[model samples]
Target: MNDQQLLRYSRHILLDPIGIEGQDRLLGSRALIVGAGGLGCPSALYLAAAGVGTLVIVDDDEVDMTNLQRQILHREQSVGRAKVDSARDALHDINPGTEVIALKQRLAGDALLEQVAAADVVLDCSDNFATRHAINRACVATRTPLVSGAAIRFDGQVAVFDSREPNAPCYHCLFPEGGESEEVRCAVMGVFAPLTGIIGTVQAAEALKILAQTGRTLAGRLLLLDALGMEWRSIALPRDPGCAVCGEGA
Candidate 1:
């Protein structure tokens, strides 16, 4: 770390658990964020601000006027631009030292797996079930750590699925692929603005912890937040040995 870097990240360096060593690890880590909307915005913001070395953000959508409500990375001028491009500009402005690889496309198949394999941590900030499952599969296949989060209406949830742990549960273990899991769109459901920020920030926190190897992450637990009621719940998630994605039968 250069003199400027040391000064820039002095706050993180001050934390006993995330002292110089953890800050250094964070400075050398690569994170793959799978969205550029509500959750992705804050997650990328914090990670880049914290000095994560590399951030690869993937998104195929363009910024819409509606997104300005909760997608903190975009401005009114960014409405017509691709979300990844807008996010790159915003992140660069905040921390020019952090390398941002903005891929304006929906990553799937080999492309997704390759990106996940190269990343130290993957943040599943996507909104849909299909994309979430795809990201989870790639992380599991590559044995990478995944920080997943979701928010809708007045509810939100966050969980970490670290395939490096033998007994840790993958996303598929909790929500099966073809189950009765319905796709709830924020556009249709009318999500609470701050709800997304809360969940996205938590996702960022978990991802940073994974990269720095600091305090215990939410690896085997699911965190649920009911913003309307101002209540929080932690649910223990168990690995499903029968899960097709990370199961003994496979």
Candidate 2:
């Protein structure tokens, strides 16, 4: 690291757990974040600020005025812009030295595989089920660790799925695709702004831990938050022997 970089990341270097070695690992890591909305915003910001070497952001949506409430990466002036572009700008502003690749298009099938294969870790920040399942599949195939986060209404959840670990459950193992889930959107049900921030920040922390290999990750655990009741609970998730996404027979 240069003098400027050493000084910039001195705080991280000062820690016993993250000393200079962990900081170097962070600077050598590449992360793929699969959304650019609320969860993606804070997750990307924290990763960038921590000096992650490369960040690939994928989002096909444009920033909407309604998104400004919790999507901290987009500004009012960026409402009409693609979310990935806006996120790239915000992340660059946070850490200009970090490489930010903004793909303003939906990543699926081959595209998703290529991106996930190149990343050391994947962050599932997408709001919908299809993209989440696709990301999980790609991560499992590539044996990459995934940090997943979601927030809607007064609830949020975060988890890590590492295919490197035995018996670790991917997102599909916990919430199967095509299953019955409450169909609620922020536009209709309303979101607690800080709720997204809380989960996304946790996602970022987990991602960093996975990248630096400095601490234990939540590979087989799921954290659920009920912001309305100020309650938090954690559940142990077991790998499904028949999980369609990452099972032994899958």
Candidate 3:
């Protein structure tokens, strides 16, 4: 690292777990973040600030007044513009040294797979089941680490799925695809604003720990938060032997 780079990331280097070596590893990593809304915003911000070498953010939505409530990456000027572009601008402002690639479209199929394959870590900050399932599949196929998070109403959850680790459960292991999960949007149910920030930041923390290879990465655990009740809980997550995505059954 150059003198300026060292000074910029001195705080992270100060951590005994990170120090200079882990900071360098972080600077050599690539992270792909799906979604540019509430969760994606904070996740992208911290990853870039921590000097993740590259960040590719994907989203097809345009910023709106409603998003301004929790999507801290966008501004009044960003409304009506593609969310990925707005987030890229914010992340670049945070750390111009980090390369930010913004894809302003809903992604799937080979396009998503290619990006997932290239990334050292993938973060599922998207809000829907279909996208989440796709990300899980790609991560499992490529043996990449995934950090997933969700927040709606007063509830939030975060989990890490590292297929690189034996017995680690992918997202599909916990939530079956096309299951009974009713798509709940903040637009309809109303979400607590800080709830996204809390969950999003935790996702960022988990991703950094995985990149730095320090501490546990929440691979087999699920974290649940109830902002209304101010309570937090953790549930053990086990891989489903019958799970089609990560199961013994093909």
Clashes of each: 0, 0, 0
Candidate 1: give the clashing pairs.
none
Model 3: per-residue Cα lDDT over 1-250, one tens digit each:
9999999999999999999999999999999999999999999999999999999999999999999999999999998999999998888899999999999888889998899999999999999899999999999988989999999999999999999888888898899998877888888899999999999999999999998889888899999999999899999999998899999884
Tens digits of per-residue lDDT for model 2 on 1-250? 8899999999999998998999999999999998898899999999999999999999999999999998999999998999999999888899998999999889999989999999999999987787788898899999999999988889999999999888888888988888886556677778899999999999999999988888888889999999999899998999998999888788
Where does candidate 2 clash, by residue pair?
A: none
Q: List the residue pairs that clash in candidate 3.
A: none
lDDT of 1 by residue, 21-122 (tens): 999999999999999999999999999999999999999999999999999999999989999999999999999999999999999899999999999999
Candidate 1 residues lying further than 4 Å off, grouped into runs, are none
Q: Residue 228 deviation, candidate 1, in Å?
A: 0.5
Q: How much does candidate 1 score in TM-score?
A: 0.99
List the lowest-lDDT window of 10 residues for candidate 2: 180-189
Number of the top-ranking candidate, with lDDT as the measure: 1
RMSD of each: 0.6, 1.1, 0.8
lDDT of 3 at 152: 97
